[model samples]
Target: MKPQHLLAAATLVLATTAFAAGDPHDHAHAHTPLHGGVVVEVKDIDYELVAQPSVIQLHLRDHGKPADVSNATARLTLLTGTEKQEVVLKPAGDKLEATGSFKVAPGSKAVAVVTVAGKPSTVRFVLK
Candidate 1:
């Protein structure tokens, strides 16, 4: 084969390999919760939050396994129409939970600020 043709083929092969290596095809945001809650991802960590009429719970997982949040603190903000309320969540076993009467409707939206090891991350959810 000609040297120029060989060089072109090698360049194509290298480019393809590099592109495949950098491709984010893992679908990181497509997480199905084990507890049937709303799931969101932050920094590759999955947070599943369940909202009820008078209670809220947050479950943290790392790669589908339960994660410990004993050293973490969380605050939840709920918005419905023009009213907004916030609640503080304390670590409870394998999850973070809070008890308070809340107004959660079909169009309500929630934002959770989770602080683990002193670093804070936010997750948002809009109810269907």
Candidate 2:
């Protein structure tokens, strides 16, 4: 391979590694599995924690899921400036929803806490 190609490839890999939030076990924002019917295609996903409603809504492009997340529970931790806010989630039918005690403002770092089949699970996502 040409030197330039190798350099570009290395930089691409480094960029992806550098942006990772934290160590896998250190944070709740971990890998999330695609459950339900046909996994929906979510693009430019946005997340928010509304303290008053005790709910976190995952806003993304409408896609089809094979099943519903009605029985799922969502947990969330908002990380920003060394601050972490923890929240619990409940199923909101199609969307895996959760309510949090902390009022996370817009553009906060967030991790999706999805409780699947009564077992505590998580989905990692950055609030954008």
Candidate 3:
């Protein structure tokens, strides 16, 4: 093969190899809700929000393992049509929970801001 053809072939091989390697931070795992709630994944962490009429719960998990939320706090904003409600959740047992009247319904949306050890992460959910 000619010198130019040889260099082009080498470049093509390296590019193909790099593409096949894929991303190191890519998490292609399934996120199934443990509490029968809406689950969202952020930065490899899963946040499940179980919104009920009388209580709200936010569960955190990292790679299928329960994440530590003992020093964490969460604030949720729930929107159901024209009605909006906000609630603050404290760490309770293995999850963050709050007890109060909430307007959670089908097709409702929620935005949770969870802070753990001074770092905060936000997760959005749509109730079904």
Candidate 4:
């Protein structure tokens, strides 16, 4: 290929790669688990689920800041093998919490349907 043609092709490839990489600043919005639980993000909000034998907690955060769960409610479905358990969580302090005898073990899965300000979002997690 001619020199000019090769230069144009290289520039195009570089531009495409950069565009596909997305904005570097977007890393600031990445979600991380805060309560030593599994975290999933939906609609720019982070939901962390902490599953324990005696209690379950769901923590919410937006842009790394604690989100208000004062009026929010969540319904969690816990799956362990063929046994499924359901629990309703209500706002308690800065997180949604429910207390009961739960079956939480390694490799258990849970799905949380959370509602905040009339908007509902679903978050799924696999316990470790």
Candidate 5:
């Protein structure tokens, strides 16, 4: 195409990215959860943050094995940028919920040490 058309297209793309980057309304799909185990990934997790029951702040997966996380004995390592904290995890219904303690600050990274049956396991979650 012409140079002017190319410039206009480039300008349009930059404008769109800038708009998406700076606007809070563009927070679509940001609330989606990321479920993974055996490897740490940056995704939303379905773990509760402390005992709020309203906010879950943990990352874990069943791994589809009876030998993995079958008994539920885990610890959630919370990291708020520079600050670090730990939350105990217990079997709450079908999910592993943090025990009554601290409210997991939003946007904090979480690393978990889960002990299932008699085996120790690990997983990490990057805050949504």
Candidate 6:
């Protein structure tokens, strides 16, 4: 085989191996939200954040089963441009609920800190 042909084949093998090793879009998966909100997975738990004008709700599901939030406590930070607000959430049945006058704009972001059974977890969401 020619030297140039051998080099080209070696380069092709390396490029193929590198592409197969890592995929940048591996995290992009189809997730259907049970509640009408943004869902993020944290520590094998799926947390759905529903933010309205004056109410914020966090719903949790474990492997498609509703997880209890009865003894869980949560704090939500809302960021809209230069404005920032925080809300504390308490257990309300199967989910955590917080009510306040929050400015959740289109480009806003939300970070949730939840402690369930004394274990802390964090979830993040970008408002649409």
Every model's TM-score: 0.76, 0.43, 0.79, 0.81, 0.47, 0.78
- lDDT: worst 10-residue window of model 3: 22-31
Cα RMSD to native, each candidate?
A: 6.4, 10.4, 5.6, 4.6, 9.3, 4.7
Check candidate 6 and list the clashing pairs.
Answer: none
lDDT for predicted candidate 3 compared with the true structure: 0.92
Clashes of 6: 0
> Model 1 Cα RMSD, Å?
6.4
lDDT (10s digit) by residue, model 4, range 1-128: 99999999999999999999995545576577879998888877889999999999999998788999999999999999999999999999999999999999989999999999999998999999
lDDT of each: 0.87, 0.49, 0.92, 0.91, 0.53, 0.87
Ranking by TM-score: 4, 3, 6, 1, 5, 2
Better of 1 and 3 by lDDT: 3
The best candidate by lDDT is 3
lDDT of 2 at 108: 59
Model 3 agreement with the true structure over 24-58: per-residue lDDT tens digits: 67565568988999999888899999999998999
Q: Highest TM-score among the candidates is held by which one?
A: 4
Span of ten consecutive residues with least summed lDDT in model 2: 36-45
- Better by lDDT, candidate 6 or 5: 6
Prediction 2 TM-score vs. true:
0.43
**lDDT against true structure, model 2:** 0.49
Poorest lDDT segment (10 consecutive residues) of candidate 6:
23-32
lDDT of 3 at 65: 87
Question: Which digits, one per residue and each the tens of the lDDT, describe model 2 over residues 1-128?
Answer: 99999999999999898777453332223223333111112232223333333555542221222334566566667676677877666657556555545545545566665544565434454443
